[model samples]
Target: MLKTYSVSLAVGILAGLIYAVLDVNSPAPPIIALVGLLGMQIGEHLIPLVKRLINRQPVNLHWFRHDYHHKIGDNPPPSGDKTS
Candidate 1:
């Protein structure tokens, strides 16, 4: 995730620099571009949920648990050690 964010930030900075040097406005205004990005992000998250629903699978939100160590590349705590 950090790598993805870094690459996106770099590309955005480069694009902005190019536009500034050319003294040309961005083809899409910032707010319009932001809204498009928001829509894309929403779709990215929703697609999986929609697919799961179509397949009649329960939507699992286990990853959102406070003690979900998987996100840190660590083994999840043993079942007996689970805080919840």
Candidate 2:
């Protein structure tokens, strides 16, 4: 989880810097903002579509791998599992 967070932060900063540079030369701020927002929406939609097309599978979230771990968090062993 910590690793994922760190990577996400790096990607987010890179994206923001790119966006700022693009916006700086834009002729009209309002129009540019609208287009930027639309571009974001299209990119969001396209990413999952491209991913599905490439992988040919539904995406699985990382957290589901440990569903059982979360459910029994910090619990002591049951009586039947006695140690010798």
Candidate 3:
């Protein structure tokens, strides 16, 4: 998780530098950009959640907890499991 965050911050900083060099305005304000990122994170989970529903698979609190951990690479499910 730390590595993922570190890489993301690095890329963001690089992009900011490029934008500065090009004198280009950011497409959205910081808050808006953050909200968009949040939406993206939710969207990422939504697709799989819907797929599970469509497949007539169970969707419960346990699944949500497992999926959350899997996505964050924290306490990931066992290798034999298909949840990830």
Candidate 4:
């Protein structure tokens, strides 16, 4: 998770730095607009996918955690085993 956010931040900063050299009339706007639209369209589903990959979690990208947020309600307390 940390690595994913770090890479994302680094890429965003690098992209911003590169684009800062360009004028407003540049074609960067359309590409950025498309990326932003795609991000907004699929960001929530994407981040958890990235996090699962980063953590080596044994779950698919479109699993219940990311695609379905609340299908399972609050879990009941465990038995008196007192496990962590």
Candidate that scores best on TM-score: 3
State how far residue 63 of model 4 sits from its true place (Å): 21
lDDT of 1 by residue, 1-84 (tens): 999999989978886787689675776588866875787667766776687679996665553343433534566655664555
**lDDT (Cα, tens digit) per residue for candidate 4, span 1-84:** 999999989977765676667534334668786885587558756776688779997674335544344433544433453223
Error of 3 at 55 (Å): 0.6
lDDT of 3 by residue, 3-84 (tens): 9999999978876786678676776568866876897688877898899999998998668767655676667676677755
What is the Cα-based lDDT of residue 18 in candidate 1?
71
User: Which wins on TM-score, candidate 1 or candidate 2?
Assistant: 1
Stretches off by above 4 angstroms in model 2 are 1-16, 19-28, 57-84
Question: Tens digit of lDDT per residue, candidate 2, span 55-81?
Answer: 885544332222222333545444464
Candidate 4 — what's its lDDT? Answer: 0.61
- For each candidate, what is the lDDT? 0.66, 0.59, 0.76, 0.61
Query: Using lDDT as the measure, what is the rank order of every candidate, best first?
Result: 3, 1, 4, 2
Task: Tell me which residue pairs clash in candidate 1.
Answer: none
Off by over 4 Å in 4: 25-32, 35-84
Candidate 4 to truth, TM: 0.32
lDDT of 1: 0.66
| Superior by TM-score: candidate 3 or candidate 4 | 3
**How many residue pairs collide in each prediction?**
0, 0, 0, 0
Model 1 off-target regions past 4 Å?
Answer: 1-26, 63-84
